[model samples]
Target: MTLVVFLLVPRLHLLDLAGPAQAFSTAADLGHGYELRYVAEHEEVPTAQGVPLRASVQWPALTADDLVIVPGWRGRFAAHARLSKATRAALVAHHASGGTVASVCAGAYALAQAGLLDGRRSTTHHALQDELAARYPATRVQRDVLYVVDDRVVTSAGIASGIDLALHLIAVRHGAADAAKVAREMVVYARRNGDEPQRSAMLRHRGHLSDTVHRAQDLIDARFADRLPLAEIAAACDVSPRTLTRLFSAATGMTPLRYQQTLRLERAENLIAHGSTVDAAARSTGFDDARMLRRLRSRLP
Candidate 1:
């Protein structure tokens, strides 16, 4: 089993800790061999949400397959001040030993303190990006991103971005399909990649209250790479094809097929950027041939 130790600090932002933890827990429930653990310098931990949490002060034996995550906390200066020297040393040693380390939101401060981020590209909560850069000049801070990964060191933007980071880790270890299953179980819209902006396409277009559109989107998101007939989708939603088309187009400013193609394009972009040739990316994302993928990509603005 891979051990995931969350380094707990005072005044923790609940989601920054819970989001990633929940993703991994769900992955474990889905048959991934992950063992989650919590560690803190003190037995009793206080959080900004006014909840007192308890953790083990004892550190566990770690292997290269293990991960140490520092969840973001409230009050940047005060929370960063509480990063104990021992905790910083542990982070450095773990990364030196080839174990992965990550941070969410202002938790990047903790990694910075450990000197793990020196000469690495990282990011944090948007509001804190400037300060994180100012204090850690050796670190290249990426702004307006969900997360950034430099080697085994990962850092994410504020709050819910932690979920994206965790999902990414799951994808890297297992497979994209496995991570998507966990995300579907958690009712996440879709998995966001590190390259995408903080507000990815799958998330940015979900603000509408149209239940029919939302339901269509959920189905489309789940199987975007598959062949989907509009009639089948409309029937599933108890609407005619024309009605589904009109409603979906009005709600999302794109037809259902267009939406699916958009998802395909996004995934294809990620795949190609990761060194997949056009033909391979096309086949992987369910394209009949490379021509369609090329045509779609050529239209990108």
Candidate 2:
């Protein structure tokens, strides 16, 4: 396989760079025909922590290939935006020509900026979930699974989720058993599909929302069982109820009530599945009524 990865300068995490690089290299060592190339916006790229990276090729030099990996950018995503216009255009063109595009963590931001994620499901670091959805309303940002493969595009959650995703791709291209051997060599257990929640249970902050609104969300999360109204939350943020509803919905896909319900139900499901009873799980997740919880769960399925 021939592959070229585009790393954002001044923000590429070492692991994101090394994970796929090592995966393909090991595949080659294991008798698979694989070639990997790492490119960047400039000839000499530097990480967010100032570790200099020697790019194999610059942006202008990159051309179409079998696969292109975009590593997460470093620093605050809003502060450190995605690729330059030319680079973004090139990526769009490359994907349009039938190439696979994969992103780890903040790398999804670049893909979203290029409009590649529109109407597709993707993921990133759980902490940036709200920001991602706010920026790309057309994109369905999933947080509960390790990675989601939407056609030719694949996206993983923050950090080590990249490893899981990389191994998955390797398994798909080569074989699961071969990928398992590689993962064992790397000291990571071979994980199967849907092995873990892709998204964190914690809510993310939207940069555009006020600090007060952010605090309000934290409060609601902490006390999900409390019947807090939108008016109460808005008052806490010194905003009108309508304003609060709009901002919260914009930050997250659902309204405040829906977001709270989703979180509560997620917690309830986790608690109910094992040794615990349904009532116990419901109570643990702040639902006083087990019937209500079961109704909600039934609706979801």
Candidate 3:
């Protein structure tokens, strides 16, 4: 079982802690072999939401495959709040042993305190980005992104973005399909990429609130590499293919078939970047031959 240990601090943001936890828990429910655990310096932890939570002061045994996450806490002055020497040592030791460490929102402060961010790319809640950079010049603090992952250290923008980070980690360790399943279970329409400039074709047109369109997108995401039929997708959403196409176009400025093709093209590009031949990538992404793939590639806009 993979252990996910949450390092709790006083006055932490509730969603920053809970969002990722829920994602992993849902993945566990989907039989992902994930086991969630919590640790805190104090057994009684106070949250920004006025709810007092209890956690074990004792940490569980950890392996490199396990993860330690520090959720963002409530304070812009986190750089000044000193973590215990033991805590810093533990963070350093864990990472040195090849375990992954993640931070959410202002939680990047904790990782910085541990000296883990030195010479590494990371980010935090946009509100804390300037402060984090001012405090630690060695750490590269990025802006305008959901999250940044450098080596085994992952840092996310802010609260809800934690869910994005969690889904990303899931996709990396498992596969896109497993992450998609967890997102589907959570009712998250998409598993956003960490570096989303919000430009990826899969993410670009998901801004609308049409349930029928969303259901169509879900089906397309799950089976984008297949010869997906619009009739089948529309039937799944209980709409006629014509109605589905109109709704999808109205919501996303793209038809359902266009969206599916974009997904396939994106995956095909990734495959080719990873050294797959054009024909191999074409076959892998469900294209009949390289000719169609090449035609689509040449039309990149």
Candidate 4:
């Protein structure tokens, strides 16, 4: 099992901790063997929202397969708000020992203080990018990106970008399919990859709150590789075929069958990229033959 340790600083932003924590926790729920731990400079720390968080003051032994993350905090520019010397040393030692180190939002300051970001490409919240660059001249600060992964050190933009960072980690350690599963369970409409446009079919047709459409989507999500009849799909969602079609279209801008086809095409393309033959990819993705796959490919610009 891989150990994921979160190093919480005082006045931590709630979402900076919760978003990534929830992603990893959901991955565990989905049967990934991950062990999560939380640590801090003190036994009890206060959050930016005025809530007290309890954590261990002691650090745990970590290995190369382990991950250590620093969630962002408020008052990043305050002298008293800085990470303790012990915490900085811990982060430096972890990275030197080949363990992965990550930071969310202003937490990048902690990693920089540990000398982890020196001569490395990193990023912080857009509003603090200039400050981070000015403070750490050796670090290359990337702007307007969701997150950056350079070497084994990861850093993300502010607030909700932590979720994207965590999901990207899942994709790296597990697979894209596993990441997509976690994002779907979290109801995340889109998983942004740096500054790239939306690419994952699992996230493409999302961003609405229709229970009927969601029910239908759940069916397709779970059984995308199987041949599901429209009537059966409609029945599972407790609606007629026509009603299901209309609702699905209204919510996702695509018919149920089209959605299924998109899922199949995307999966098949992944398979093909990984060296699967057209016929094999077709069979794996529920297509009758390579003809349909070829036709779909031809239609793409």
Model 3 has an lDDT value of: 0.84
lDDT of each: 0.84, 0.70, 0.84, 0.84
lDDT tens per residue, model 4, 172-285: 665456777899889897444444422456665666788888778877877887889999999998999999999999988899999989878877765675467999989988
Better of 3 and 4 by TM-score: 3
**What are the per-model C-alpha RMSD values against the true structure?**
4.1, 16.5, 4.3, 5.5
Alpha-carbon shift of residue 19 in model 4 (angstroms): 0.9
lDDT at residue 93 of model 2 (Cα atoms)? 80
How many clashes in each candidate?
0, 5, 0, 0
Sort by TM-score, best first: what order?
A: 3, 1, 4, 2
In TM-score terms, which candidate is top? Answer: 3
**Candidate 3 lowest-lDDT run of ten:** 191-200
Could you give candidate 1's per-residue lDDT for residues 272-294 as a string of tens digits?
75568999989977899999999
Lowest-scoring 10 consecutive residues by lDDT in candidate 1? 191-200
Per-residue lDDT tens digits for candidate 3, residues 1-301, read 9999999888998999999999999999988899999998899989999999999988888899999999998878453347899889988998999899999998999999999999999999888899999999999998988888787899998898888788777766654556767776787665444446423455556666899997888788778878888899999999999999999999988888888888778777756754689999898778888999999999975
Instruction: Give the poorly placed runs of model 1, Cα more than 4 Å off.
Output: 30-33, 58-66, 78-86, 89-100, 150-152, 167-196, 269-279, 290-301
Q: Report the Cα lDDT for candidate 2.
A: 0.70
Candidate 3: stretches off by over 4 Å: 79-81, 187-205, 229-243, 261-301
TM-score (C-alpha, index-matched) for candidate 1: 0.77
Local error of candidate 3 at 153, Å? 1.6
Error of 3 at 139 (Å): 1.5
Superposed model 2: Cα runs more than 4 Å off? 56-65, 190-301
TM-score of each: 0.77, 0.61, 0.79, 0.70
Model 2: per-residue lDDT, tens digit, 82-167? 56887788778877887678898888888888899999999888888888999889999887677877767889887677777777
